[model samples]
Target: MRGRFSQAWSDVLRGSAFPHEGQAFLEQVFSADVFRPRPDHGGREERFALTYERLRHINDRVREAGSTVPLVQDRERLFPLLAWSAVADPALFYAMFLHHCMTTGAVLEFGAGREDLADVLEELAATERVGALLMTELGHGNSNASVRTVAEYDADREEFVLRTPEPAAVKFPPAVAAEGVPRLAVVLAQLVVDGAECGEFCFLVPLRDADGPLPGVGVRPLQPSPWLPLDGAVVSFDGVRIPYRFWLRDNAVLTADGGFTDPFGSPAIRARRTLSLIRFAWEAAVVGLAATAGASAAVAVRHAHRRRTGGRFAAGRPVIRYRNQQRALFGALSGAYVARLVAAATAGPEAPALTPRSVRTTFLMKVVTDRIAERVSARARTASGALGFLAANRFLDYQGFAHSLNAAAADNQMLLLDGAQALLAGTAYTPPADEAPAAGDRDLLDPATWETLAAVRERILHQELADGLRKATGSGLAPFDAWNGLYDLAERLAETHAARLVLGTVREAVREVAGSDPVTGPEAAGILRDLLALHALEELAGHDGWYLAEGLLDADEVRGIPALLDRLCERLEPYAEELAEALGVPYPLVGAPIAGEDYVGGLAGTAPSSGTA
Candidate 1:
């Protein structure tokens, strides 16, 4: 029964989230011998070389199979492919992500409908020239709008002089320079025409060739992070000349008179559009994170079921039988499923363009999903005991990957604050309808009740922020003061909004499952619904103090959350191995010793103890 339901649940998840191309890549390329994890033999350069080798191997396999790396424009195909890579290897995933999503995506997106960029696009598609994106400066942090890199147009030469003026202007932490590969980056810089700043634009700047870093370009690799080793570097440009054709102009015109004209009259709007490619990066990231979360949970649960502990009273019981252990493992398993559902909703060919609405949603999605991945990975690592710390088990690697994302793409907290500020500025955010009578009106077990509670919290917080903002400003506080005074509320509102969205996505999956496979499907659906309740209860418990103070959840109700959570964990306990299997992570990809049938036998120089040993 467990096996049947596990297979059914796996079908429901992978069938909904991964596209055919993505599924095929995972089965064929990712499962192949070339993509397996190998021991690191040397130092930084050698590790980076191995990453590139894996990347080249995958690229070759994909090409040989008559498909190229899917760009952000084809994110439905792109995301799942990246997700599988992330499951296989973090370093390989990071390199592939940058190459396909950041670099190739920038060229294809920013240079869309332009004839001049066709050749370069082909080179990127063919993996001839590696791609990278340079946007965030060392000093500017998340403030891409304030970057000091300048591209001054020299009319006489018809070339743009790209320069990082001061120490602060150097682009930080992109793996732009590899030893033998030619690399190009879509660099964001303030464009100047005859000393007049004409907003920021992306320019295709060459960073390196076979010889070394290109003349007038500087690349200094940063200190290696042992957990996630990449060829990350700080790059600076000293008057590197960019040709006229390399400008990634979208409906912008430059004539012989040294004047620039754009459809967007507002400099702010243009700047937003210039940084729009980051949206795709966010989308790609969550998908990879979803996969990592799932893979991590799968590894932990598999290990839990096989390993035995508690010899004081019971001679040897499965570690998974403990309530505390069950919580750690199943909580992660549930979070992984929720994360995947959220990722599935966010990515696809039908994903909206860079509109105001899409921007806010995607930003929130990235921030929330980053936190989910972080929490899920941490729990998975803890559940596996000492084995989780080993690199070969992949739990530490998964945790490192998740931690890196919290800062990469964009800092998660900063993204939330920015998103909250936008929401506070009259951006359209419809609170979930007032359906459930405030708090005590519905059954706790109903998914509808959880959804309503989450929505209500978000709505109340949003309203409170708005009312406080008006009151503060009316009392003669400056605009900045008004915002800073209520900063915490705004941040909470953003987080609640994201949690609400995640809750809704998980519930949607439950309903879909409930509607399918009348026989075995109902069992899988019940398991998923329990997961949804678990996720909702977890979020609600986090804000229980707030909920109690707000008079939404009484003290008694709040106290009962732990017991309810335990019950959910207990009910789901029998299916722990099934849930892990349902995540659809390949067996080779898990590759943890304790997860195997014979844990002691799998360990090096270890044998099963005989009774008389």
Candidate 2:
């Protein structure tokens, strides 16, 4: 048992290498997690109390590392943990970050605020800590060029006095302080260059000295976030004096004399690097949520397989006897597997090219991950029966993660539109869309992006990002079937090209790394070949409607996809455990909710610990 747990820990860490275990572990530890059925006949209320207590303990740990003091003092440890947690609960991601900055005595200039910052995080990180930055007003999220927060140079006092003119100019949804005390605030007020607004730059302003609130910084927290615990707030400035040197450089370089130097290309590019940091977080969060859902399904299946009921073959056999249960379990498991692969592969980052295809792929992958997680979790919860809804069962935990992931970010949709735009631009992409389209009519090849994907793909989106976002706005299609729809023929072509890019690189890398290995070895090179074959077969399969209209595929090759997937699943079956191991998820033994082959009795969390199965 100890060995298994250790191995499980190793597997998880191998995937993330972060300080914390994924949230899925949070649900199953000591088997006292949420979603657990009452064991030893304990009262449901008692069990729930236990679960909440467990969660609170974890939350306590989160506050400890995520607080401002921890962030400032132990930044190295804190950043990795924050990145990892983003993989788990992205909603908690930014909130915790803001909390850390406020509690740790750091200043925000463009994104977060300063008023009451110290108080809020002090409760979490300890007292007498605060920071501030009120840059993003209610008027915009990324339109920095249109910013209204003004900071004019007061040459006499040698300070920049900041002010907010209109209500929209007030930075609502900005990071703020609690208890009205702040130490340092780098406000992102528009720098009045030669009597004109010269873009935006952060200015270091002392909001509160050891005595009290500085001079002109004011704030208000958003009443509540839509889903997650987003402690959003509004902020404004009135003649706030700040000594410079607070601007996070790499974009709009500001000289001490108030002159600007933005030599690294456009301001948009530089600004995007900052957004990339958040994007990294979203990516990590989406992946983490998917993994959590996978664990939830695994647990639910363990319970379902053990809980007995009437069956066709046996007299009230295990619930796993039901086809409905298997369909739910296995289908979700497959999705979890696919999602896990995608997340692990894409979790790092992509390039900063604002190209539509790249944006489309990124957005599609996010939506795909989000949808799979939400759907699988909802199904898994139902599979757990009444126990799933109970706080003790841990289903609600997964639901919390899923709903939160679904409730953030509008950029995902924009990415999809960008993908459509990429498709329109004639970017060729083709890999396997189906196996043997037309039963070995190898002539169905489409253009592939072999060159670009082969070279540099950037370090995690060309810089920083913690990962995951929920909210879906715009066409609502992103939340609906946008991810599900088959893209245009051009899109399929792009997919084919993209798949080749990935597979080709993998094929080459495997040659160097797995020269003597099996499956990946020469003996099993067929698997890789078949995988690529399968990819190509499927890539063009989706554009059948358009393909048929455009004569991309003849009538003979259209009917082979089902067989292809069927064959692929069968071929991939023998290597499933090996592949799962390589990917770093724990094996089935550790995934059991309790302990039983049938997943019932004492193991299902319903019965007492009278005997082991």
All candidates: TM-score: 0.95, 0.59
Candidate 1 residue-wise lDDT, 315-425, digit = tens: 588888888998888888888988887788887557676677788889789887778888998998888888777766777888888898888888888888888888777
How displaced is residue 61 in candidate 2, in Å? 9.4
Q: After superposition, how far is residue 34 of candidate 1 from its true place, in Å?
A: 3.2
lDDT of 1: 0.79
Instruction: State the C-alpha lDDT per candidate.
Output: 0.79, 0.46
Superposition error at 491 for model 1 (Å): 1.0
On lDDT, the leading prediction is 1
Candidate 1: clashing residue pairs, number:
0
Local error of candidate 2 at residue 314 (angstroms): 5.8
